[model samples]
Target: MRLNLRTIWKMIRELSGDDAYERYLKNFHKLHAHDEQHECDTPLSKAEFFKQWQDEKWQGIKRCC
Candidate 1:
């Protein structure tokens, strides 16, 4: 397979969880930008996005089996 620098960088960010907020914002705009009710609403700030991400990640059941 052929992978360029941009693809490599994107893979690194994805593996490191560094682009979660950016992806969220992109999806938000793509899906909500034209919706009247949501047009005025804003995507979460970076801090808020990370906080929520962490909460959802760790606040679930923990099992070893």
Candidate 2:
């Protein structure tokens, strides 16, 4: 699917509610933890990298809202 930032953000807000953004932040932290545990030195683990990317992007939207 082709999802722009605005569309993704709106979907998250609608489906997960305002707290959904918080969940993303939490997932970011979790991904950070996973990265650390594996000594990945990246923002996320291979399995979670995409999710982390999306979450971080959504987080920016949450901050603005």
Candidate 1 ranges beyond 4 A from true positions: 1-3, 37-40, 59-65
Q: Could you give candidate 2's per-residue lDDT for residues 1-65 as a string of tens digits?
A: 45688788887776755545456557767777755546544334444654655566675445543
Minimum summed lDDT over a 10-residue window in model 1 is located at 33-42
What are the TM-scores, per candidate, against the unseen true structure? 0.70, 0.29
Instruction: Please give me the total number of clashing residue pairs in predicted model 2.
Output: 0
Q: Per-model C-alpha lDDT, please?
A: 0.84, 0.59
User: For model 2, what is the error of residue 30's alpha carbon versus the real structure, in angstroms, after optimal superposition?
Assistant: 0.3
**What residue runs in model 2 are displaced by over 4 Å at the alpha carbon?**
1-16, 37-65
Best by TM-score: 1
